[model samples]
Every structure is written in structure tokens, then in C-alpha cells.
Target: MSYFDLSKFPPSSAASDDGSVSSLLSISPRSSRSIILDQSFFDAEDPSPSPRGLAEPPPQRSLPAINDALYSVQVNNRRRSTNSNTTTSVSSNYDSDSSGRSGRRPIKTGEMGTSSERESDGEVRYQEKKSKPKPKKKVSVVISGGDKVKRNGGIRMAPLNVPIKRRLQTAAVLLHGFTIPLYTSLFWFLLAIPLTWPILIPYLIYCLFSEAHFDGSAPRRRSHFLRSLPVWRLYTGYFPLKLHATTSLDPAKNYIFTYHPHGIISHGAFGHFCTENTTGFEGLFPGITNTLLTLDSNFRVPFYRDFLMFMGLASVSRRSCEALLRGEAAQPPPTWSAWKPWTWWRLVFLLPIFHPAPHYTAPTGGGRAITIVLGGARESLEAIPGRMALVVKRRRGVLRIAIRENAGIVPVLSFGENELYDQMVPTGGGMIEKLQMFVKSVAGFTVPLFHARGVFNYDVGLLPYRKEVNTVVGRPVFPKAQMESPRDGDLDEFQERYLAELRRLWDEHKDVYAKGRLPGKEGEMVFVG
Candidate 1:
């Protein structure tokens, strides 16, 4: 018999009572012998075997049997002591040991077999046991000023340290989004005459000199000159923007950066391009001169032309484009002119012949770059926060410009650019739409009925909401020279290729930076020249 055989029995305590008990009985059944167990048997209970019809013995029944076996051993010892008087005590002790050994052997064997059978049948029998629960600690609370008060049965509380920078940033964001726009509008309205006059004067001059000789430096610097005013900085203080660039851009390389989804006046573009201290423009792209292009009418004012140039702005005219592109290395000091006297007539007459040295020789050299809001003012009316909808319909002029100038095209996608202002209605055609289009065609920019947070209130005016702006610069697209105008078929193919590259750039990094914002759908490069 093997140890696993449950039917095998061990030696009985009754066998020790008679001399007739054989040596075989003393040896017990071979199946009852203990052996080193398999590790798997102890680790996991196998459930493949089915249980037999025999039910497990009740606890009460097993306990009485155990008690009886112990009682019998005591009774046999007592009888042995009486039978031999002097030697009886000694014999009784031996008999008691033999009985105890015999009884315990069967009990141990039975327990082992039962446990194994139950485990094989997947029936686990756990002895009922309960553990005492741990006592709760007493909590104590300290009260300020004169008394140390004990509370919550003496429980101790840990101190929490809040980060000061994170708290301040959150506060700044709330203030910009909720309180700045109202103050900005109020300030603008109060000083509208003074502000409007300065801008108005140069704007008229630019229009009068529309076909006149072009001098690049004066006009470009005047556009951003308003930033120098202490009052203007106060207005922008409510919504401060920080600019950072991943790589340095060479100024000598003429670049045409196409900005998308024209936000209401593109406050982001203005902040980044027009101001030096705010955007850190000089630090990021060292040696790369940038001009944020504006409509020709912007430089028409008398005082505004000088102001715009001071602000680093220039006209977005084709003539202005050629002049800047063909401009000299660095302007000669104003005093070192061949035709000195610096009169308006002399400056105007000498301008055409006084071509400044080329700012850029090779496309790869350090040169000036132009940033065009390609979506234009119509796109501004359609601008929705978190979604980019470019207005490329019939807008092949930019492509032509790229090819003509031999400039590399850099598509710029700005996330959260549109989140700044809430528009009058949803972005499509209607009576309002016709009016906006007419205004754009005549005035160069549409007046968007937009609103954002005020300086002292949560709503009202044309300021941008306090949302992070992430501007991604796509890889450059080099233009191929063509002797003649591109056919419709060739144009379509080129546009398709350009759009594909743009979409690829958006797809790759959009998830990394714009996880929460709505994603742009399959963009249609609608040509609406």
C-alpha cells in the first residue's frame, strides 16, 4: 500500500492489550509510513478528482473518539498497576507509553489522509479562528493663543507646503482671463483721440506715398514704436506673453513664414514680433532679423510711420518686399549720405537709386525673414479656439511670392491662437459675413465683434483669453524655379504636396503639445485667390 492510499489503516491502540498482537501489527501498515511530500501538493490544491459519496465526519463525533482513545489508555494503565502490585507501577508506565504511541499513530494517519483527500477534491476546511482588531490611536489638537487644546483623541496631523510659483502662475492666468480686457478698452477709449491721431497721421502719409520711392528702415521701425510708450506697456501688463524658440534662425537666410488661422488681429503674432522685451525675440533667434508684415495703409499715417518703424514693423507691399529683400547689409549712418541735407525731397528722390546692400546674399546666409498672416482678416472672423481653419482658397499669391523670391516656405501652426476672443456668431456665411468681407476688401482688415476678459471684470472687450500659445515651425519647403506661370494641374500638384507636408508636421507633434485641444480634421487647401 502506498502513502496516498486512503483506505489503509494504521496500528490500533487495542493491539497492545494482548500478547497475541503480532510483530506485523506492531510495525503498522506500510502505506501509513510518512514520506517527504511533493512541493506542488502543499502549494496548490489539485481539483481534478471528484469527491466520494462519503461525507466528512462531524467535529463532535471525531472529538468523542479521540477522548475515548485517551480514556482507554488511562484504564489499561490502572488495570496493569493492580495486577502486579510491586512491579505493577513499572509495567503500567510501559503499557501507557505503548498505548499512547499506538493510538496517536492511527489518529495522525487518519488526519493526513483526510487532509489529502479534501485537498484533491478541492474542499478546503479551515478551522474557525478570529484575530483581535488593533485599537485606534488617540488624536490631539493644539489651539493657538494661550491654550494647547487636545482634540480627536490626540491624533497628529502633518503640515502641507504649497508651491509658491505654481500658485502665483495660476493667479496670473485667472487675472489675465478675467480682469484685463475691460481695463484695456477703457484705457483705449479714454485716450482714443491722442492714440488715434498718432496712428492716423503716418497712415495718411503712407497712402500718399503709395507709389513713391521706398526707404526700408524708417517704415519698418515705426510700426512697433508704440511699444516704447510707458502707457502701452501698462495696457499689455495684464496679459504678458513669454516667447521661446527651440533653434536659432539665421538672419541671412530669407524666409517666408506662413502664419495660420488668423486670430482677431493676431495678438500672439503682434506680441511676439512687435515687442523685443516681451517675446525675447532677440535672444531666441540671434542675428535673424524679422519683420511682421502689415497692410500698406498701416504706414500711411504721419507720426505712425516713424512709430511703426520704431516697433520693428514694415509695409506688406510688394515694393516694400523688394526693397527689404534687396536692402543693404546695415544702413549707413544718417550723416554719411552722398546727398546730405536729409530733406524729404532728397530722401524720396535718392531712395530708388540708394539701394541698401542686400540683407541676404544666399538663401542659407544670415538675413531678414518675413512673417505673413496667410489666413488674412477673413480667417480672423472664422477663428475658433483650439481648431485651426486656414483660408488658402485662391491664395496662391504667397506661393508665387515664395517661388519668385527663391525663399524657403516655413508653415507656422499656432495652437490656442484662436482661444483669445469669442466671436459674434458661428464662423460662416450670412448677412454678417457679407458685411465682413466687404469691410476686409476695402479697409484691409475686418472688424470682428469679439470679446474677452476685462481688466477688472470677467467679460467684455477684445483681449485674448489666458491660454497657452504653442507655435510649431514646420520643416522648410524649397521652391523650384519655373520659366513660366504654373498650369492649374501643376499648381494643384504643388499645393497638394505643400499641404501634405503641413499636415504631417501637425500630426507628429500635435499629441505631444496639444493633447487637450481639439484636433484639426483632414484640412482642405481651398484656393481662393
Candidate 2:
């Protein structure tokens, strides 16, 4: 809509020879910036993940600040009476014809043309500063007696030590955190019953053929409402997980994040990478879409399958990994597709020998990343609170996938992961350890005989302890001079370089991140695969 002054036309500034008078025209200076910037607009629908709901600190910009701010001239559109009916330049506010909010009617882009064009159009020259909004001050109040009272505060969050309100909130969150695992376990039991076969059979068959589970169908994971549920925030506050980037990762490159020391459930990986809402990971590493990979066996279960998928969990199995890397319809599991239905049982029996189910294998457009708890179940055996023991020593599963996919690797070291649970791992040959190993050997996964503090007390439950878990993502290690089917020597060389990088990362910050660990030496680590 074009804006103009509404007033009786003033008499012509000059008379014509025929004694006829013309209305005087008023002109003003105004900037039409929108028209200038219109041709430079670009499409911003990039696939890169953007930051959402994160309270990140302001970035440290390297560019020098501008010394002066320049603003374009605008216009005041109200009309007024002048002593003479002549062309005149004016720079004063005029009354509005409406209910009267008194402010200059700023010039808008596209409203008028060039200065000469505007002069011909009878516009007035106006000079005014651009309007600026006033900054609002944030006030903090201590909630005592329900009356607001200002309090001085520092950059740190309030301590969660003894506040009754905060404690109650924590208790609720602890309960909510249990809901997922409890429901998944419960679904496994309920769905396995013969009575539920009619429903279970159909769903399982559907999952068998459907590609959604592995085709990057991640709408659910991106749901801000679900991902940012207060429960996760509480879960985060419970151990109070923190994610760090030792070096920034380029969004233009794909990555395989190999997480170490898969303590118990690999809770560190879940809190940091599984949910973008939980950690504001995009704020830390913008444009990288990180999906946490889990056992394909997890997806074989009924409700549990959907639950994991909703949380953006993908199968770590070979074909599943390959499918994700290629971003195509998932190729069916080898045994399932290759073996006869009558031979399925025997195929399951031979699974361990044929396929190490929980492992992943990459792409272009280059924004994808998968978080692999590289230690798998073996690391759970070495999980000792306050100590750094990883089964990554001989674990080349991730490297194998990395080499095949040619994806860069990053070692993700999550300190204090083991401290969250106290696992009861007896010596190697004990009956209990034997049973655990048997389960792992047959089923490909073993539940750690672990415990953490309960909601009501400081002992005996599945809840992780209230310790600080800092996950630092080390620098990317790109394998150089590699072949599609990499040689063993080449793989070893890359692994050695990766190990050095992992060590460098730990040695550089272990003192700070593992600060409150049980008074251990700097390099007392158990890194076995």
C-alpha cells in the first residue's frame, strides 16, 4: 500500500500566463532498501541441520567491529500549513488523520522511486534516524514466600544440592527416564507370548519389509516437542551430561563418531548425540545430522523397535549400516533373506559366526554422521567406575566400516560414563561372567550386571548416578592413501593414528573432565577391544 499525505491541496507556488493556478507538490527523501536487496535473495532450504532451542553462548566472532553505523534517510508523510504556497523542503512531524499515534511515517522500499523521480512525483525531503528498540534487562528473583525479590546471580547455574523443589523435580524426571526402558522390556515380554501372535506376527512381517527403519525416516527424532521433553532435561540434569568439541567438524564432510567405553547402556551417547534437543548439538556443530546406531536386534522387537526408531536409533548391522551410508532402501539381513524359512532357526544359531549384528558401515551431500558405541558389549565387561577401560583395542568393526565407506572418523571420549553404574563383573571364568559371555556369544548382546542409585535412595536400581558426564568429540582422522577394499596394513596404520589422536585428546583434558574420579593417575587406562 502506498502512503501519502491527506490534506487540502495548497495553491500553486507559481502562476501560469493564462492566470490558472496549480496545486503545490511536496517531496521528501526516503530509502527503498527492500528493492535494492530483492535481487540478491537466495534459497535457504538447505538440508543442513540448524540450531534449535539451545542456550548457547554468543560465538566469538573474528571479524572486526564496524566503527560507525550508517542509516538511510526516511520520510514524514503528514501534511501541514505553510506561510507561502511554494515548493519547500520540510523536516518536521505532522499530525495524523486517525486516532493519532505520533511518529514519523518512515519511508518504505518500493513506495517511491529515485530522488529525481520522487521530485517529479511531488515527494518531500526528510532526514531522520532509523528507529532502534530499547534493550530489556533480565531480573532474577529468589522464590521465597511466593514474593518476587531481586537477587544477584553469577554465570553458573544454581547448585542442585538441597533445594526441595529441585529435588522433587529430579524425582519426577528419574521416573520418566525409566518409562522408555521399562516399556521396551515390557513390550518384549508381552509381545513374545503365543496369545499375541496374531498381532505380533503381522507387525514383525511389516518391519521385515519396510525400509523406514533404515531409510533415514527421522521426522519423529526431529520433533521438538518430543525431543525436548522436560524428562530428557531432567535426565540430563541427573548426570548433568555435557558435550564438548575439541575441534570443530566441517559440515561438508561425513563422519563416523566412534564412542568409547560402552558403559552399561552407553547412556553418555544417548544424552549427547541421540537427542538433538537434549544437548543442543546443532549449536555446537551446526549442519551435522547425527544419528545414534544401535543393535539390529533391538529393531526386531515390537514396540521397542518403534521406540528406538523414533529416537533416531538405527541398526548397527552391516547391511543396515550400508543402507544408511548409501541412503537407500535397506537390504534385508543376509540370513533372513538367504536362508529358507525352515532353516531360520539354524541360521539364528550360527549368527555369531556369520554376522556381528551391531555394527554400521556412509555418503555425499556430506552432512550425515552416525554415533557408534565402538566398544559394543565387550566394553561393558571392563566398565569400572572412575577408571578408563575401553574394549576398542582390537575393535576394528568401526574402522572396517569407515574404510569401506571412506567416512572420516572421530573418537568420542565420554568421561564418567562408567561412574554412572556399578556393574557386577566377576573374574573372567566365574559362573556369572560365563553366563554373561554365553549370552553375548549367542545373542550378540549381554546385559551388564550393573546397578545405580534408585529414585528414593542412593543404592540399588537401574538409574544412572548423579555425576557429571563430559563427552568430548576429538578431531577427525581421515584415512589417507586408502583403497575401497582397504588392506589390513592400511587399516592398522589408520588405527594407530586414531589411537594416538584419542590418547592426545584424553591426555590433554583428562585431568579436567575426569576431575573428581577416584584419585587415579593420568594414564591408568584399559583400552582393549
Candidate 3:
């Protein structure tokens, strides 16, 4: 066998090879004699100087020819030194023993050296370890009862959700439709029988006689006995409105207020002009009694007629308009000693009845005025929630009314009125549009398929949503009074001036209330007949 030199192997492999040899020798390297033998008998420990001198190499130690040969020599040398040291320790131990029982004891092998036995032991160990099982990991407990567990383990209960304003609005709507008419009829009936029957009875007889016998075109004295009903009060209180006057309205002068974008039903007109709900109208412009004109057909409704008349709501017919504007002021009863009278009662009795003649006349010396809703039914259909698009094409009728009456046309712009109800289907055009027009034409007002909220729930009902309505009364447009029919050019000029004033009103105050809306459409005015 070729003897191998020890220095050519890597350090880790050489050390491992020595460990295997000690297992074959049946001696533990940990013994004292093994330590001594390793220190004194290894090749590195040979102390003799080289034959050439202390620094000279050995003369004929040839380099190993093959790589394996070099590795084998290194491994063999390491094993020889380790085995020799372990054997010395074992022999010394045997000599020192008093009882010779070494042959009877089992030979101990190192863990790494005995492969088959370790494999068998590993199988047994793995089986035993597998059978023993791992302990379970702890899981967090969530004790859910009344306390709700938040994602982070905190507890909270849900909050209550309710709409209080919607309930109030529903109450208002119910009061307007049901309770108001009942109360007004009772109050008016009591007053007519007890005190005013004599005057009212004669006036009605004269009105019937004149309307039937004479040329119904003749002028007549209008009564004020039943015009102070609480229904109007209830109607006005339903909205948040403020009446601001740029200039004092002269009571002696006749006037016309042309309300624009006639919302749903001219609710703003009913609240602002016909009723004294916003501010004390009698106090604001003393002696100035205003009437909200409606379609003439409204006077044909059974109970609604009396209720409307009691609230100072008259027909917009030519006869009704003239009669309301030219009627005489009510004279106070002679004698101041009757006991201090109720101011509201006295005003109700004494305020002038504005009954102008059936022919639309320029104000007497130019003072009489009439108010018409410029947008009419068509614009009411265009009142979409959160946006306004006026439908006023060929709407020079209001200009004509202003010019013919010589009444300074005051344009009233109502913001937030469109937001009151959410229309169910989109409005503009289609089958529904045609149907809406047909119904409006026949019934005098179209019922928009709209929903707001129930008194408690947000899902369904006829009550309007509790949106704030701010009706802005724009600056008055005083067109040049013409004696004869207004010429085509003059009518065009009046329309332009009126439109400009309306646009200015919207620009000045739209931001104050309608801040969330897209900017008013550029030149978006749509004129209608």
C-alpha cells in the first residue's frame, strides 16, 4: 500500500476523518492519555532537524502524482495519529483495571460513525416524537353578547338613525291639505252669520245680480269680510322666507309682482304675497294689500274655492284681475269710542280692495300693478332637484301684462324651492313628458311623480323634503309706459330688460343658498308662451 502524506487535505475533511478512526479504535478522544498522545506523537510534533539543516527541505519527498492520492495520504495520516492516541488511552485503561471485565462490556461507538444503528434509532425516535404530539397554540376569545367587538377588540354599540326635520315637514304638508280648509270654513261661517252677514249678503246679491243680469263687464265693489283665514298663515309658515324691499311700495300706487320660475305651484307667491307669514306685511308696507292670482279654473273646485277666496287667492282672469286692482278701500266704522279694536281685525276690515276694471288699464296716472308667474306650468316641470332651468320661451305675455298695466314688473327668483321634492323619473321629454303635459292641460296642474320621505322613514311618501326655500325678490323693471298697444320693438326691449334683471338677481344670491350647484348655465333662459 502506498503511504499518504497528511498536509494536502482541506482542514475540515481532515478533522472529520480523524473522528471516524477514533470510533474504530474503541477509545474516546476525551480521555487523558489520548490528549498526551495527540500532543507528543503526531508528525507535526517530530522535533529532529532536517538532514540538510534547520531551514532545508527533505531531499527526496516527491509531490503526490494524483489529486486523490494527495487527499488519501492526508486523510490516512490524520486517522493514524487519532487512532494511535485513542488506542494508547484504551491500553493504559485496561492495564490500570483491577477486574479484567473489559471483554464482557459492549463497545461504545461515536454517534456519527455508526450509520445503520443511528438510522434505526432515528426511526424509533421519530415514531416516538410523532406519537407524543405538539401542544396547541392559544387562540384569542371574543365574548360577544351586547357589546359589539370592533376590529381592534374595542367594544361599541350602534347609534340611532332618525330624521327629525322630515317628520316636521310631513306634519306641515298634512296641515296644509287637511286641517287648514276645515278651520277656515268654520271661522268664516261664524263671522258671516253674526256680524258681516248684512254687508256681505247685500254685496253677494249685487254681485250675482250684476254678473247675471248686466253685462258682467261692469265694475263692482269687492268684499274683505272673509280674507283673513288661518290657512294662509299655515301655508306661509311652511317655508323660510324673508321679504326685503329695495324701495318703499306706495300703497296708493297700483303694482304688479311677476314671479318667475313658477315652482311646483307658486308656493313662494302664496307664502310671500298672499299671506302675512314671513314678516308682518301690514307692518312692512302698511295699507298695501297683495293678492296671489291663480288660474281661473281653480274657482270651480268645490270646497277649495271658499278656502282660496278666504286666503285672498283670486282668479287671474281678466275680470278678477281688474276687479282686485280697482276696488275701493274699506272705510272704518264711525265712532272711536267702541273699545280699543284689535289692530289685525281693523286692518282686515279697512285695507283697500284693489279692484281694477276688466280691461287691463295703465295705473291710474300710472299706479295699478298685477303679478303673474312668468314660467307657468312648463317651468314647473323643468324644476329639477339642485338645478334650475327656466322655461320662458315666447313668454312675452308677462311683458305685455306689465306694459298694458303700466305696472313696474318685479321679478321674483326663488332659490332652493326646486330641492323640496325628488322627482321619481327624469323630467324633460318622452312618453311621461307627453302624459304630464296632457294632465297639466286638463287638470290645470300636473302631479309630478315625486317622493321625499315619510314622517319617520326616508323611503316613501308625498311630503316634501325639509329643504330651506329662499325666495329672492329681484329689482323692479319699470318699462316706459305706452298709451297704445306696445310695439313689437318695445316689447322686445322690455323682455330684454326684464331678463337681465332676473339674471342679475340669480348671480347675486345664488351662491348664498345654492353653493353646491354647478354655475348657472350660460345664457340658459328658455322663453315659452
Candidate 4:
């Protein structure tokens, strides 16, 4: 998320592997020419003067000087001979300086001085300036384009010489990736401890019955402190997720963000929406309080459930969606007895079930947003390493919700999301695919058999491989007007426009962000039902 600024570091005190003195010098490119100067440039009096007493612009103010040895090192590295074109040519007003007039003039380029002219007092001053060692400063200059000295090609393991800070960053991401399993194990382990049952049982009851997720009020349990943790920066640096907003979103209007191709875990979605500091969600879309929507079943897990809620994630059900967009409270949880299972069956199923609603409420939209991964778990099955496909064609539910709520629909395309993991994708209508669909029908979510790099090793584990994920937020497509009962034609028209915008976003950024994408059809973005 942050670039390493070479300016902050001290100059190297030793020689580099290439047999060149690694000392940093104040070299800057001006007019496509590398201007290398010695101690004469920073002296009390300028040795070189401007022609005809006119002030020529100074070489763009250089970085702080470090070592005198770098002067020789830089000159040798360029491998250019001192001449009319390469060396620093000066225009001196030696006669004017001798007559007591100010001779301080700017540096210029031209022919070299005569041997007798070079041996003048100015030359003696230059010799004195070089002989006396100038104090080294604790500053450096960043190369114009990039300062990354060395890079290796192909897949390689983390080098042993990796910095401690980078290692800690990897650790932070590893901890986050195992959050669900870690919390699950911790929850069961706590249950085993009879002494902690007094605390754990009540917490378990609260996690199971709390209607906090459904109410759609500002999440009281959502810990801003936790979400703003420094660890999220490392998590982001793991894949180094970058968020791009194509157009500024209006805070007065509500938005429904449709995230595509739920890659493995939808890490892009979580980083961009769930946490503010990760992708600078707050700064990017100012005044908009966006809540990431996930499967309601996730709240069924014990400790892991609490973790999701704390991250400001809400249920992706009709009631929660409606409540959030309306900026109003949802219908209060209905009270029912355990003995009368028949009476409370609807209450249990209706509250969390993702049923499409035809009824529309009076628009009371504000600076609120609900981010839904359009592809969901079904599309996750198609998440291969280098391919980009989405189960998006049939998913018009978000559009309908946006129409009813009078909210803008923002299509988000995440490049390199599918490259995070390798999955065992079944052939079309194959037995494996059929079995996966059957499970999804029964449990509402299906798991894709996937694997990636390990903790310490770069092979065989659940940790998503280190890849760059760029999540681009396209312009919001607002409804023409609020409609109590939107027509099918209207919904289709909106969907068409939304899909077109999404495709355009892909085409605009695919080459830059998806260069690693597979060749031909496998790499092309496709829509499926």
C-alpha cells in the first residue's frame, strides 16, 4: 500500500556487489541529461557563471549530498569521456570578478576552458573544495522511474535475506487467512475448558441469537479499532491489493456495489470494503459507509461469526439489504418459543433466507452502501489460477434491489483476483459439478476444492499466493427514477447497461493488470448462469 522512499534512508557506507561505491549522490535528470556535479556546485561562490550576466536556470535542485567518492564512481559508471558534449562546460566572467563586480553566475554548457584558464584562482578554489572532505548528509534520491535494483524472473521462494519487516507482513496475512479455522478451533477449545463455560456459553448464545446483523443499524459490535489495525496493511501488502475509483461517487445517493468473480475467498472485497485502512476505502469513497454482505450461514459459526460481524459484514438477505438502503430499522425480531417449532419456523427461515421481494419502500436513501459479491460461492467453483469467468448473467437480484431502493448500482471489476489460487474445477455438467450443485442446493453454499502456497514454503497450503489484485470501482449507474414496482423490461435494460460498463472496465485495464492471465479463451472474461 506504501512505496519505499529511498530518500529516507542514509547513503551506503560500503561498496556494492558490482564493485561500484554504493554511496548515494545528489544526481538528478534535467532535460533528459544526468547532471553530475562535485563540491563546486554547493560552494559559497559559484565557479561557473552565466553567459552575459543573465541567470540561467539551475539544474533542478539536487538531492542532499552524501559522499565525495560517489563523484568518481558516477563518472566511471557513465563511461563517457570528458569533452564538449559530456563534461560540465562553464562561462566565467573572470575579468568582471577581478574588477570587484559580483561574478556569481549559474552553470552553463559549452567548450572547455584553456589550460591557462583552468589553472586560475577558480581552479585553485575547486581543488581546495575537493581536498577538504565535505560532511556527508543522511539523505538519498529516488530514481525517476523506479529504484528496485534487482528482480528475479519465474516462481521463487522467499529469500532468506528478506527483511524482518517484510517477514512480519507475511505473518500478518497468514494469521488473517487462517482466521476462520483458528477461531473455530479456539471456540471448541474454550468449550472443553469447564472453568470458562460460564463466559463461553453466554457468548455462544449471544452469537447465535443476536439480531445485530439483521437490524442494519450502524454496527455497534463492529470494532473500528480492530478494522483500523496496522495488520490490515500487511494483509493488503500480501497480495498488495490496489483500489481504483474511476469516477467519484455522490455521498447523497446510496449505492449497491456488485463485486464480480468471488475469487476463492473474495479477499479483494474484504480488503476494499470490510476494512478502511486496507485499501483506503474511507478516503476513496468519502462519506459513504459501505458494509460488505456475506452469506447468512457464516453467522452460524461460533467465534468466527463474531469476527465477521466485528468487521462490519452484514447478511446478504432481503431484510438486511432493505433495512440498510432505507436507512431505517428492519422489522424487530419476532419472539417465539422453542416448544412451538411450527409457529417460529417462518421466523427462523424468513429472517435470513435470500428471497427476492417485489414490494418497495419509500426511498430514504443516504450515504450508505451494501457490497454484494455477484458471483457468490457458485462462481467460486470456476476460480482457476489464470482464468476469469463469472456466474453473473442470471444474477439480476442486485439490480432489482437497487431499483426498488432508488440506489445507484456500481459494478466493480477486480483484475488478478482469480490468480490467487488453483481450484479443481469440474467439467460442464460433470458428476463432480452435479454433486457440488447438489450440496449448494442443500446447504446454500458449496466449497471449491482449492489450494495455494504454504506458510514458510511456496507450495501446498491454504495461503493465497502473493499476487497483485487491482479492484477498480466503476462509475455508478443510477436508476432513472424510483419505481414501486419495476418492470422486467426496465430491470433487463439496467442489467444490460451495467454489464456493458463492467465489460468496458475490463477492456480498459485488462492488458496492464492482467498480463499474467492465461492466453486465449481461458483468460477472457465470460458470463455464465
Question: What is the TM-score of candidate 4?
Answer: 0.63
Better of 1 and 2 by TM-score: 2
Q: Candidate 2 regions off by >4 Å?
A: 1-181, 184-201, 208-211, 215-224, 329-364, 518-523
Any runs in candidate 4 off by more than 4 Å, and if so which?
1-157, 329-365, 428-430
Residue 265, candidate 3: alpha-carbon lDDT: 54
- Most accurate candidate by lDDT: 4
Ranking by lDDT: 4, 2, 1, 3
lDDT tens digits, residue span 1-529, model 3: 1122223334233222233111011112233111001211132333432221223332233333232433443455456547777321111111111353221122234512363553343211100011346896534333212212222222222213324442354465666655446755754685567676544444334333322111111112223333344544444555555555545676566666777667665566666765553445556556555667777665544335444554556567656555545542222223443342322233344434332222322223333344567677777776667677786557776566567656677777777777667776554678887898898889777867766544443335655554567776666787788444788899988888888887888778777867756545632334444
- lDDT-better candidate, 2 vs 3: 2
TM-scores of the candidates are 0.52, 0.59, 0.53, 0.63
Q: How many pairs in model 4 have backbone atoms within 3 A of each other, for residues 3 or more apart or on separate chains, i.e. clashes?
A: 0
lDDT (10s digit) by residue, model 2, range 32-127: 222121111112232333322334432332212100101222222323314454343344333222445433344444544575565454434443
Global local distance difference test of model 1: 0.51
Clashes of 1: 59
**Candidate 1 on 161-263: residue-level lDDT in tens?**
3244433443444443433344445435644677455543443454475432235553322323245444333323434444434445556567777776578
Residue 418 in candidate 3, Cα distance off native in Å: 0.8
TM-score attained by model 2 = 0.59
Number of clashes recorded per candidate: 59, 15, 29, 0
